[model samples]
Target chain A: MKENIFPAIRLTVICLLFFSGIYTLIVWGVAQFSTNAGKGEIIKQDNKIYYANVGQKFTNDNYFYSRPSAVAYNAAGAGGSNKGPSNPDYLKDVQARIDTFLVHNPGINKSDIPSDLVTASGSGLDPHISVQAANVQVKRIAKIRGIAEGNLQQLIISNTEKPLLGFLGTERINLLKLNIALDNLK
Target chain B: MNTEITGIILMYAAVVAMAIPLGKYIGKVFSNEKTWLDKIFNPADKVFFKLSGINPLKEMNWKQHLVALLTINLIWFLLCMFVLMNMSWLPLNPDSNASMSADLAFNTSISFISNTNLQHYSGETGMSYLGQLVVMLFQFISAGCGIAIAAVVFFAMKETTAGKLGNFYFLFVRSCTRILFPIALVVSILLLFNGVPMTFDGKDPITNLQGDTVQISRGPVAAFVAIKQIGTNGGGFFGPNSAHPLENPSYFTNIIETISLFLIPIAMVFALGYVLKRRKLAWTIFSVMTIGFLLLLIPTVINEMNGNPAIAKMGIAQPMGSMEGKEVRFGSAASAYWAINTTVTSNGSVNAMHDSLTPLSGMNALLGMMVNCFYGGVGVGFLNFYIFIILAVFISGLMVGRTPEFLGKKIEAREMKIAMIIALLHPLLILAGTAIASYLYAHSPVAYAGWLNNPGYHGFSEMLYEFTSSSANNGSGFEGLGDNTPFWNIACGIVMLLARFLPIIGPVSIAGILANKKYIPESAGTLKTDTATFGLMVFAVIAIVAALSFFPALVLGPIAEYFSIY
Candidate 1:
């Protein structure tokens, strides 16, 4: 028992030093080659900085819709609402989101609202919306922005992120990028 | 789009391509053969052995190996628990996080030691830098311990008429230095270069476009995330886990993280072939596991891609499938694939919320953990599958009127009893734990704080998923359970320990005892496990055991939730 206990404890201390101290420093050194040096990808547009990797809330109808966030797109405290589907509060929140969307897009049916638009993402700040989510709001955004629906559709098609390997994930659009494009539309 | 496909193809190609050689390299490492890295790591190995008083050349029998494995694990557990409970005074604690409650510390220590990494506390705010390092250190050692024990099992399975398996301490050290360290270092650098933060500083404050200030938690995340996936210890550096922008910044990083989860587990399968000089048998087992993995993966992907029918009824089109809990970068397909991959291998990191998944997809994840043998954790996966193979051989032996013999060892009551108990123990712990939790939730008002956040079927599913994940030693949870309470912290701690150690002991003991038996030449009538028929039979046995044990729980939870959702 002593042989086992003493050696195990000694080896563990050595491993702890190597993996936690030395190995982490090595990884930190390699992070120097990465974009932003692991400080996060920051995009400066019109002198305002935006984290290109994080979800940004865009509530105005003239722009493409962003996914709902339980944390209000707070990158500092990223998380889902941790609410179960049947939780009345969560269900009410979704219902309220559905109501708000219907009021903005009068022609859209309640059943036609994508769940992504109404429900908060697990990472409270999901930057992308399903291709269907973008499409459902296309009518509302075109009417408000006065851009031709055809041109908007073209932009959506161009921005669609295909599943990796055409087999890994579903197609979706980065709402931040799409809204930025919407503001730039001539 | 085409480039995305290319990336996926390249990643899969890379894992198999690299794993084949990695498997052979691992084989050589354990056999004490001369290798290139031995010059660097050999001296370190001797230092380790000397400090621990382990004789590298002295082989231990199965019992001694088990004793060594358990004692060392306990030592690490004690060390980790001490650090966790006393992190307030520990150095490098920039955040000055307080010590964890005794219950949480016990749960966390056991979780990491068992290679489960089931985190009940949110990491960013809950743990200081000192605590993070403590957790990261345990990740490496625990994963190494698993591989070491697995090496012993492989040795026991192969060496006929030898009473001794290899040295546990030697295998543990070699596993870390040769296999886990190199792969983890490479992965860490890859992730660091892909934008995962690797700083030692405290949380950074950033003001967003909305004019709201937020504190961005930064740490040695790249180092932790690398081994978290590579070692199959899926605890996150942050609360949202890999879904965080800094943890998994881009599509490329997501692919890397997902691939890392399966890489070592898959390599271990190939290593079995190389070590035993039985490539056919290894490939057959690999096929059985992969087929099971793919079967679950495809349905989960399709269900998630189909989106939720309840939301569909609200007149919203689900053209991009289900995106409820998934990130846009990951998409429904990738997130579903991750769900299946992580659960199948005991890698519990999540890029999306399992709780938000559609009913059938949720069930697919549950079933993967329930079976708990597909691909599996680094070294322990094959150990679990070996149990089913032994049972299959025993049952088939009875039908053919031949005494069951595995690798020249006669199967007897003692061996069968251990295997049965080990196999039976998994479901017993899972179901019993869930039953107790459910009862407490109903009868005891004191147990009702944050226990079930959702009522009805989804609520039941959350409780059920927790126990299944714990009992399988796959620590990903539904994220909806308020599991930080004393009731949960202690219950799951006990479950994770028993679930992890018992399965390991059962297989290694059987193999160790068998290795000592007298050799008998193979006859024509002897069962060939490498053949397709026998592989299918083993698969059937796994499916049957899983089905018989978990069907009621599944029906009451995910299946019921599915019907309710539709």
Candidate 2:
């Protein structure tokens, strides 16, 4: 045991330097050539900047809402509501969200609302919503903006990202980009 | 087929495909056979040994290996504790995050060093850059330690006479340099290209289109996440793990990270086959583990894709399935697939919140940890499965009225005692720990109100899952459990320590003892361990042991919740 201790200590020190210092430096150096220089992907529009991947709050009637955020889309920290399926209080919260969605879009029935629209996401900063989530909100956005609903539908279709290789992952739309496209419409 | 199902199929295909070749390479590294990358790593490993003033070729018995593993792990624990508690004033803490409380430090340190990675604190707020780096160090070494010990056991299995196993330091260094480092580098670069951050800068404050000012946390996440998945450490750079947008970024990055979770563990099985010169044995073991994994996985995917029944009653279409605590990009199918993969392997890094999974799906996650040997965590995973193999061998031998021998060595009462104790220890720790917590929660519901996020059956599950994860050294949590308190921190700390070392000690000791015994060559009377019949026996042993012990707890938690909701 005593003989092993010094070797263990020496090895630990060397490993700490190799893994923490050198390996991290290599990754950091390579990241300098990556997108946005590894500061994360960012987008600038009309003097406002947004993280291309980070979800944002979109409660206004003029924009498509991202999924509900447990941390209110606070990027400083990420979390989920962690509410179990059978929890009455969590179900109540979902019910409230559904009622609110119905209130916003008068013609859209409750069944038309996708579950993603009412439920909070795991990361609280999920940038994308299912295509169906964006589609359901087009009516409210069109009615408020006084744009033809057909144009908004076209925007949704264009912004919709197909599943990777058309077979791996889900079809979704980036809420931040879609809303930016909404404002860019002439 | 739907994209979600197709996505899962592709992910599994990619993992198995990668694991086969990687497993062969790992086998070569341990066997000291020449490999393509040996030129680069051989000299690099020599530096590590010289710096440590140790000879790489020095022979170590099983006891020496355990001592070395534990001592270094202890040092790592102290180093991690110091960094975490003092990072507020330490260099490179750009976020200006405060230091952790003593109890939290204890939990975090033990959690990482044991390879559990059960986080009591959120990374973005609780950890500074320096702290993240230190934890990342553990992510590499702890995993290397596990892989090294597994190599030791492999050596023990191959020897026909009492002899020293290979040096622990040599195997450990080689594991980090030749295997973990190269893989992590490739994965990290891929993540960086996909927008996972790799910077030492402070948070980027950005104003969204809504005119809301949000401080976007960014750091060396790509590197951290790469090792986290590859090592099966599962400690995230952020609290939400892979679900965090900046941490995972896109579906492509998601596929990469998910594949990493299965890579080394599945490879280790093949490595065992390679080292033992028993390819059929490896396939048999792989089949057994894959069977268990699919059993848990298929149900979880189906349940998650079915969405929540209670929400369905409220008249909403769940075209995307259950979305609470899940991301739209990965969808329910991928998230559920990741959930089962993470648990079964003891990877414990969630792409979605396990707490919010449907009751049956959540139960499957728990069962994965409860069974705890389906693929499992890197090197230690095989150690857990080895215990089952011994138990099965003993029981089947008794049933057939023959003395048990495995791999040409006799299995006697000493080995059976160790195997039984180690197998039973998992349940004992989980059950006892949960029992104590339940008593506390029930005895003073008002005082411990914050202990549970949901009431009734699901709440019981949160407690059960926590202890099971700790005992299994699987760190994914039912995060709803407000578990940052002193009770949880200290309780889980001790549990993680005991669970991590004891299981390793049990298996290595058994193998070491058996290796020293006289080599009894296989005869007509000897049982064939590599046969499909033996594989079935092992599977039956795991099912009976894990299911019988954990069923009552499951009844109270997810099963009750399932019936109540549906």
Candidate 3:
């Protein structure tokens, strides 16, 4: 055991240097060529900067509300509600979200609301919502912004992201980008 | 089929296709054979040995290997504790995160060094950049350590006479440099392009369209995430793990990360086959593991996609299935696939929250850890399966009234005793740990009221899953449990230590003993271990020993919850 100790300590130090120092430096160097130079992808809109991938809270009636967040879309410390499927209090929260969505968009029934819009995501900072989730909110946004419902529908269609390779994921729209596009519309 | 279903199928295909060749490469690497990467890594490895003053040529028996493994792990544990506890004042702490409490540090350090990675603290606010890097170092070495010990077992199995197993440092260094490093490099770059942050810069505060100011946590995520996936460490750069958008940016990245979880584990099985010159044996083992894996996976995918029936009772459409704690980009199918894969491999990184999964799916995840041998964690995974193999060989030999011999080495009473103890240890730790926590909670509900986020059956599952994860060295959790308190921290730390070391020691000791025994040539009456019948025997042993032991505890938790919900 004594004989193994020195070598163990030595090997660990060398490993710390190689893996923690050298390997990390190599990856960090390569990231210099990536989006936003690997600080994270950023969007500059209306003289304000935003993380393109991180979700933002958009509760205003004029904007397309992002999915409910457990951390209130706090990117600094991301997490989910971690609510179990059968938790009565959690179910109450989901039902409350449904009722609120119905109240905000009078014409749309509760059955039309997508679960993504009501339930909190794992990361709390999920950037995208399903296309169905986006479509259900068209009436609320159109009325609040005094824009034609067709143009809002057109905007949803144009912004909707197709699955990878046309058949590898769900169709979804980034709510932050979609909301930014809404603000830009005449 | 819908895109979600197709996506999972393609990911599985990609992993198996890639693992076959990677397995061969790994086999060659451990055997000291010339490989394509040897020109580059040979000199690099020389520098490491020289710096460490370790003579890679000095051979060690299994006892020596364990000594080296445990000693180095202890050093790492101390170093990790120091960094985690002092990172607030350490260099490179751009986030200004506070130092960890002693109990939290104990849990975190043990968690990473054991390769279980059951995080008691959220990464974004809880860890500094320095702390993250130190944790990342453990991610590489702990996995390398597991792989190296496995290489020793492989060597022992392949030996025809009593001889020293290869040097532990040589195998361990080679694992990190030759195997884990290069793959992590490629995966890191892929993640970088897909927008996982890799800078040393601090958090970026931004204003959204709604004019709300939010602080976006950014750091050396790309480098951290790559090793986290490849090593089966499953520690995350952020609290949400792969479910976080930045950690796993898109579906394409999701496919890349998910494939990585299964890559080294499946490859290790094939590596065993290559080293032993027994392709049929490898295939039999792979088939049995795959069958066990699929049994857990299929039900989970169905349940997660079917959505929560309780949620369905409310008037809303769940076309995307159980979206609570799941992202839209990956959807329910891929998330369910990941849940089972992560648990089965002991990778433990979740793309979706496990606590939010439907009850049966949650049970399947628990069962994956309980059955813990299906494609298992890096090198240690195969070691866990080795115990089952030993037990199977012994039991079958007893049934057929023949002496038990594995690859011509007799498995006597000593090996059987060791295997039985190790096999029983898993259930013992999980059941006993959960019992204590449950007793504490039941006796004083108000005192421990904060312990659970959910009430009743599902809450009971949170405690059960924690110990099962710790015992299996699989780090993914139900996450709803308030686990940072001293009770949980100390309890799980000890469990992880015992689980990680004892399992490695048991298998290696057995293999070392077997390698030293007199070789007996295969006779007409020798039990054919490589055959399908033998595979069935091994499967039955695993089912009876690992799975059945956890049945009552599971019934009380997930099964009861499943019936109550549906």
lDDT of 2: 0.92
Error of 2 at B91 (Å): 0.3
Share of true Cα-Cα contacts across chains kept by each model:
0.53, 0.92, 0.91
Where model 2 places Cα greater than 4 Å from the true spot, the runs are: B159-161
lDDT tens per residue, model 2, A64-101: 88789999898988899999999998898889888888
Cα deviation at B183, candidate 2, in Å, is 0.4
Please tell me how candidate 2 rates in CAPRI terms.
high
The model with the greatest DockQ is: 2
What is the C-alpha lDDT profile of model 2 across B11-36, one tens digit per residue? Answer: 89999998988999999998889999
For each candidate, the alpha-carbon lDDT, in order, equals: 0.82, 0.92, 0.93
DockQ each candidate and list the results.
0.47, 0.90, 0.89
lDDT (10s digit) by residue, model 1, range A1-186: 656777777777878878887887787787777777766666776676676767777776777778888777766567876665445566567667788888888887665666777777778778778777887888988888788899999989988887655655446687777777776777
- Chain A TM-scores of all predicted models: 0.89, 0.98, 0.97
Any runs in candidate 1 off by more than 4 Å, and if so which?
A: A45-48, A60-63, A82-92, A107-113, A131-172, A177-186, B1-14, B50-53, B445-449
Error of 2 at B76 (Å): 1.2
Candidate scoring better on lDDT of 1 and 3: 3
The better-scoring model by lDDT among 2 and 3 is: 3
